[model samples]
Target: MSSPGFKADAAAMTRAVQGFEECAANAKKTMSDLENDLVSALSHYQGSQATAFWQLHTQLQDKMRVASSELDTMSNLVNQSFHNYGSGDSTVAQSLTSLSNNVDAGGAVFGRLTGA
Candidate 1:
């Protein structure tokens, strides 16, 4: 026999979990699309154009790889932060802040690489 408050809390938890799953799915889809676009762009370049394309592509790839690694690291940090939060650790707040800063730095690098 659950109380009304307990049922409400359970519902809120379900919604939160659903939201997290949706966000994760969307992020995965976005990454997949970006990868596909890069592949398609490379495929379109051939012959003499391929040389210049390869050079630019390689540089962009390196930048993207670094950005990707940073993003992954930040994501892990965020996950850890959440875990810490669940465990009632105050350090999680600082970890979240650090993760935000790292993400901003990575975004700046990505922006420069994309000239945007």
Candidate 2:
């Protein structure tokens, strides 16, 4: 038979083991919660970043379209002016000069639109 003192020590040891198990379980749960929170925060950040990038891309595309149209108009006007000059018509020459001025104005507008 075990001595009374030895029985008491054994009981104390059992209590200590139970306490350690409880603490370990709590720590594990806390770590899991922290991991989940980190993942959620990262997902939110990625979503926000994607939205911003798409918005910027759309705005850039719109600007590019406007710039392209302006360039096309200018090219057409210049071509018309050259054709008029070749035709040796004084009235056409005057018209060509007006168109050239318009082209210059459009160029300035395009530049402003492109932030250039």
Candidate 3:
């Protein structure tokens, strides 16, 4: 078989990745609103079992938040990496510093969410 004569388009990939991150951010916001509504609805329950279930769900809220933050951080880090390689520009040492900071931020966010 002959070798394929096609190459991945970096610009398109970068655009798509960035767009995906934007979508993820919007999704996180929408999920937060929905979760709030769920919690509000949970408060109206009138049984011990229902109250216990809601308490358990409330306990998991922190885990859910951490997961969402991690998702967002990873999305941002991947978007930056995509742009860096997609541009095929490696000579700018100064910009590498910024990229390094972004990666560090992503790592830190794994432990806890921070102000965006």
Candidate 4:
């Protein structure tokens, strides 16, 4: 007996991909904006504290870049998954349709073992 087949929610997968992409874009924009604001704010004052602040800013910027890249990777992965799921669903549907056609043509759904 055949059981119910797999059901994929393309809309949900698309939304997830979009969400990741949006998050990456937001991260990039936030980092850029913050960097600009910090640069404007620290335009003057030469001191050890200013040097340390710049170092910290660089580190933060690097971290944010990494985060954005990771988010983009995730989005790509989800998008790939969506395509894979669609392909798999198509394969299964085709196989089932072939099977139904065979059965309709009076072919056995299951082959019996002659030795058994």
Stretches of model 3 off by over 4 angstroms after superposition? 1-8, 90-116
lDDT, ranked from best to worst:
4, 3, 1, 2
lDDT of each: 0.67, 0.61, 0.71, 0.74
Identify the runs in model 2 with alpha carbons over 4 angstroms from their true place: 47-116
Q: What C-alpha root-mean-square deviation, in Å, does candidate 4 show against the real structure?
A: 4.7
lDDT of 2 by residue, 1-116 (tens): 44566557656655655565565556556655655565454455557786775565566556655655665565566556555443444555578899998878899787888897
Top candidate by TM-score: 4
**Model 1: runs farther than 4 Å from truth?**
1-32, 89-116
Listed in order, each prediction's TM-score against the native is 0.45, 0.39, 0.55, 0.70
Q: What are the per-residue Cα lDDT tens digits for candidate 4 across 5-99?
A: 34436556667777877877787788789889888777774698789888878898798778777877877787888789767767787899998
Per-candidate Cα RMSD to the true structure, in Å, reads 21.1, 39.5, 18.1, 4.7
Q: Write the per-residue lDDT of candidate 1 for residues 16-104, one digit (tens) a residue.
A: 65566566656666766876787788788889897787787677667767766666676666566555444442355568889998878
Rank by TM-score, highest first: 4, 3, 1, 2
TM-score for predicted model 2 compared with the true structure? 0.39
TM-score of 4: 0.70
In terms of TM-score, how similar is model 1 to the real structure?
0.45
Give the worst 10-residue stretch by lDDT in candidate 1: 84-93
